[model samples]
Target: MTTMTTRTVAYPADGLTMVGHLALPAGTDRRPAVLLGPEGMGLSDVERRRADALAELGYVALAFDLHGGRYLSDPEEMLARCVPLLSDPDRMRGIGHAALDVLRAEPRTDPDRIAAVGYGTGGAIGLELGRDGVNLRAIGTVNATITGRPGEAARIRCPVWAGVGSEDPIMSPAQRNAFTAEMQAAGVDWRLTVYGGALHAFHHPPVDHPTVPGVGHHPQHARRAWRDVVDLLAECLPVTEDQSEVQGRLLTEPR
Candidate 1:
């Protein structure tokens, strides 16, 4: 397999130091980019690997941080930080914009051709970015069905794909309905997929630390959800010709 270069990037967000994981494709040419957001636990290896995988597929991917590089193992701490942050649209947009600026500043990123994908709390942040009227190519989210504030959803300018486990208590049926309703009311191009028999955080790998109730991993669903996200990106932000050449040279099928 061709080696994709990866790096740790530090930036500022909400008066705190934010660390992001950046992955670049093998070649030096500019390419489409993605802003990856992690779950409430923060930017773990899972998000890093996801960025690497996207880079391998010929895009500049940056796994943006949430808690200034801190991983919240304690459920209470995670909720304490995430609940308020999620509730405040300005805070979410600040975090997203900070990381997005870092990704856009990368020489290899084609800022005009970028997507945002996130999981759990990160997913909510991605949605907030869209609601803030950032011109993203696409938005893909998992395990998050949070609705935006009144009249804010209309600001989203890109297609959105959201996935949630059918059994995710955190994203209940009512929440899903509200999210979809907002999208529909705004006339945004959006789609939702509910993976059957899966629970909250189903798109994540098995956790080594104790997780709160309703959080579990389904390996099969995780991979499928990733494919769904990839499909969204392919539809909205197709790779450039140079990227296709590099991907072909790597002997891997196009993502």
Candidate 2:
């Protein structure tokens, strides 16, 4: 296994003291980076683990917080906070930019080679960042089929990949069509993957707490979505060849 360093970083965004998880790959040489966003419930162990996994793959990853260090398990609380936030493009951009700033400040991060991958509300924020004209290498979102303001998508300068569950009620067929239309009209390099028979947040792991209706975990699809996200990163913001070899050797080394 490729050993990595992980830490909690506190920063301010949208009047909240956001606490994000930062993961750094082994070695000091600069590497490509990813801005990771959690689901509507906020930053949890799942997202932090994802950041660590990205680091193990030789990328600096920052899993950003949504609720100022709080992880909401209550569906009502999550909806109350996320519904309005998702509607405001400016707010989403602010959060994304704040996390981007944090990621760029890392000494090991390559500012020119960065991608944004988010889930649920986090995915919407990543799209907002792209629409705000942020220079991202790629944007990958899951379960966030949201359309931006008129002509704003034209500002996106990188490829975008979106994943959704075919049966997701929150991201209805109409919403997906609108989102695709916006991207197509803007001339973006975009694609969408629908996990058949899955419901909303299917990419997420099973949680002990109660969730909203239509939200359920699909392990098979979740793994596939993760692989797809990794593929997108590999295509758009690959790590150096030497780093790949190092990671390969680490994985093969005996204990």
Candidate 3:
């Protein structure tokens, strides 16, 4: 196993003290990095583990905060917080950029090689960063098929990969169509995956607390979607020998 390190990082964004989890691969050499965004619930263990997993693959990964360190178990509270944040593009970009700055500030991060992978609300924020013209190597999102202003989307310079549950009422078929159309009209390199029989937040593991209606977990598709995200990062942000070895191990490891 590759040796790695983890820590909590606090930063300011939108007048909130955002707390992010940072994972660093073991080495002196600079490595490619990823800015991970979590679902609307906030920066939970799931996103933290994902950051650690990415670090084990030799990438510096930071799982950013969405609700300033609070995890909302109440569906109504989650929506109440997220619905408004999602409506404001600038707020989303502010949050993402703050985390991006933190990622880039790490000594192990290769400033030029970075990507964004997010789930649910975090996914939408990642897209916002891309639309804001952040120089990301790639953008991968799950359960967030939110559309953006075409004028801003046209500024995106990276490829986008989005995964959504086909039965997700929140991200309905019409929403997906609108999102795809915007991406297409903007001349972006984009792809969409619809997991059959899954619902909103299908990529997440089962939660202890009750979730909102239309939200459920699909373990099989969740693993597959994560694999696709790994593929995207590998294709766009090539790592060094040490990292590549770990990456090989990660790819072949049994679930």
Q: Name the best candidate (by TM-score).
A: 2
Model 3 accuracy (lDDT, Cα): 0.92
lDDT of 3 by residue, 1-255 (tens): 548999999999978899999999987789899999999999999999999999988899999998878899998999999999999999999999999999999999998999999998999999999999899999999989999975788988999999999999999999999999999999999999999999999888898997989999899999999999988888677677665577678778597
Q: Count clashes in each candidate, considering only residues at least 3 apart in sequence or on different chains.
A: 0, 0, 0
Candidate 3 has which clashing residue pairs, if any? Answer: none
Q: What is the lDDT of candidate 2?
A: 0.95
| Residue 150 of model 1, lDDT score | 99
The digit string of per-residue lDDT tens for model 2 on 1-255 reads: 547999999999999999999999999999999999999999999999999999999899999999999999999999999999999999999999999999999999999999999999999999999999999999999999999999999999999999999999999999999999999999999999999999999988899999999999999999999999998887778798765566567557597
lDDT of each: 0.92, 0.95, 0.92
lDDT per residue (tens digit) for residues 166-253 in model 1:
9999999999999999999999999999999899999888877888899888889988999999878777787876644554565565
Which prediction has more favorable TM-score, 1 or 2? 2
Error of 2 at 128 (Å): 0.3
What local lDDT score does residue 143 receive in model 1, on the 0 to 100 scale?
A: 83
Where model 1 places Cα greater than 4 Å from the true spot, the runs are: 241-255
Identify the runs in model 2 with alpha carbons over 4 angstroms from their true place: 241-255
Model 1 score (lDDT): 0.92
lDDT of 2 at 10: 98
Error in Å for residue 188 of model 2: 0.2
TM-score of 1: 0.93
Candidate whose lDDT is highest: 2
